[model samples]
Target: MKLSKRLQQVAELVPEGAVLADIGSDHAYLPVYLVEQGRIRQAVAGELNQGPYESAQRTVREAGLSHLIEVRKGDGLAVLGAGEASAVAICGMGGGTIVDILSAGRDKLAGVQCLILQPMTDSDRLRKWLHDNGWRIAAEELVVDEGILYEIVQAEPGDERYKDSLWYEIGSVDLLKHHPLFPQKVSAAIKKIGRVLQNLRKSQGGLAAQKREALLQKKKRLEEVLKSCKQR
Candidate 1:
């Protein structure tokens, strides 16, 4: 089973011999591939919707991994139990939704050692939540598939401290340093902040001054990062 570049990167981060759970497993390709490769001892593919859930089951059966991989129809981490999986992979979802799923299933994560996350959007929120909570990002990577750049984060439960400003803006600075797509991502962010600043300046309102100031500050910070990236 061939996985996308993003999914392949996420799978590579999974520790060998792990009991893995793939949350929101759309096609169950990742788990099936992992099991077949002998990377994991057991795997579970969790899906909430009927169409995807049935598809995942079919894929697992077709791959002849039904015994090693269990397809469970459920939402988020609700299908998992403590110690059932040592590592969890939640991918191809919005960061806020991923954070909500992890936040809601904190108990199930007690015995888990690693969380491999790939957020589609709002990655800053997910990073903030991880930092505020106990999870600390151990590694991060960037993968470009079909002209889209995806960020993959590997975190473990602990007091992992991150610089607040960098964490809020770029998800993880350590990851950003080695990011394959950092130039593109940071350039896009700089353009976005510039656009927001322009709009704030053009608008005339009672709070325009304050809003403009905030936007300017954000723009400056982004500019600094952009400049640093260029320097390197």
Candidate 2:
């Protein structure tokens, strides 16, 4: 089955020979594809809603991967049991939602070596949570598909901190790997923060002032990144 560029990037991050659990697995395509390629021996496709749950089941059955992939219906990591998977892939969800899921089902993460996260929004919050909780980012990927940019972060259990605050505020520069869209990503971030600063400037509240200050700092960091990219 064909996967979107975003999902394909997520799939490529999964470690070979590791069992995987694809959370919010819309059609279980990632797990099925991995299994077909012999990248993983087993997988569990978890979906929260019934419609997608049934659809996942159908997909796995149609792919004739019923023995290698199990489609289960439950919210977040609740569908998984301890030691059931070595890696967890939670994609196409908001960063705040992903944080809640990880926090809620943290106990199930025992023995899990890796986490592949693709947050649709507020990824900084998710990264902060991971850093504070001891999940060091092992690798990261950024891909733009159909004019929409997406980030895929692969983290494993460890303790690590960024030398520059921009690593967290913006993202890991080392992980960007000089992607062709690096400039575009930096430009887009600068524009997004510029809009935030504009809106915050019009507001007259203590929180707004603080937010504006933070955004200004972030904007500068992004600009520096953009400049450095141009220099290279």
Candidate 3:
């Protein structure tokens, strides 16, 4: 039932007493840990690829929680039925892929109460998608695990208007500012975007300048936030 720091963060956001769906559930570790802790009574682990899918099945079987957790092999939300689970957790995937899965399975999400997601990259795109598609950020956390930093987001059905555009880039400062790794997280973001700017400097092609300018602005904002976090 032991989980990595990143998965542990995602597990913290899962609501208790609800059926959870773990999408792209590698080895189905999160669900197994949740069930073992009595945080949830049931879960459906969905894996897209065959190898991971079988691995999930074996994990569930070996844990002797087969009755409590169902390991399903299917792509995205295809293995999930409409309103079958209240909490849907999609982790260990790219933001765009998560968006595409959620978009394609809108009907299956009819009765979903909340969504817990951990995107490997392009979290800004995922946050923007949540705002555009009638969901509000309930909670967010930045955790450094195994020398890598990860973001865990818990969203619910609602609406919101961000006070500043930076919210999309670094998640809501109000929620993430208190994290121990907040400054480090902002610094990491600045460094990542800075690398993109470095590559853009080599290409002056169509829109490259415009894109670089936008990234520079984002980097500036992030640097400002990082400075503030340090001051605090």
Candidate 4:
């Protein structure tokens, strides 16, 4: 099974010998790859939709990994209990949905040592949720696969700490520094901010001005961060 660069990057972050549960495991590719590579001892592919759930089961069986990977049809983390998995991977979903899943299953995460998440959108929301819920960003990576940029964040529950201000807008500076696509990511964000500011300037409303100013400030801060990354 050939995995996308983004999925492969997410799989690489899973520590060797860990037990993994992949939430929304569409096709169950990640778990199957990890088990075949001996990177994880065991894995469970959790899916809600019938199509993907059955597809995951078929993939596991085809890969000859049915003994090592379990395909369970369920929503979010409800399929597994605490202590069942050392790490959890939730990918190909929005950040808000990811946060909601984790939030809903907070009790089941007590034994989870690591979380690898790739949000399709609302990444800042996911980061804020992690910080608010006592999860510390251990590492972050950016990968562009077929012209789409994806951010993979590895977090663990703890008081590792992050500023509330930076939590939503920017990811971990350390991880950003090491990102293979850091320049492109920052450049793309700058373009987005610029476009937003331009639109805000054209709109006439009481709230528009305030929103524009706030976005402008954020744009400046992002520029500064990008400059710092360049210096490194």
- TM-score per prediction, in order, is 0.94, 0.93, 0.92, 0.95
Q: Which 10 successive residues of model 1 have the least lDDT summed?
A: 171-180
Model 2: C-alpha RMSD to truth?
A: 1.9
Q: Candidate 3's C-alpha lDDT?
A: 0.91
lDDT of prediction 1: 0.87
Compute the lDDT of residue 89 as modeled in candidate 1: 96
Best by lDDT, which number? 3
lDDT of 2 by residue, 1-232 (tens): 8888988899899999989999999889999999999999999999999999999999999999999999999999999999899999999999999999999999999999999999999888998999999899998888888889898899999998888767775578877737667778889889988877777777998988888888888788788888888877
| Candidates' RMSD to native | 1.5, 1.9, 2.0, 1.5
Worst 10 residues of 3 by lDDT: 160-169
Candidate 2 versus the native: TM-score? 0.93
TM-score winner between candidates 2 and 4: 4
The ten-residue window of minimal lDDT in model 4 covers 161-170
**lDDT per residue (tens digit) for residues 117-219 in model 1:** 9999998888888888888888888888999988888889889766567566576655676565787887788788787777777789769888878777776
lDDT of 3 by residue, 1-232 (tens): 7898898889999999889999999899999999999999799999988999999999999999999999998888999999999999999789999999999998898889899999998898999999998899999988888898888889999998687988887889998887788898888889999899888889976799889988998898899999888878
Where model 1 places Cα greater than 4 Å from the true spot, the runs are: none
Q: Decide which is better by TM-score, 2 or 3.
A: 2
lDDT of each: 0.87, 0.90, 0.91, 0.88
Backbone clashes, candidate 1: 0
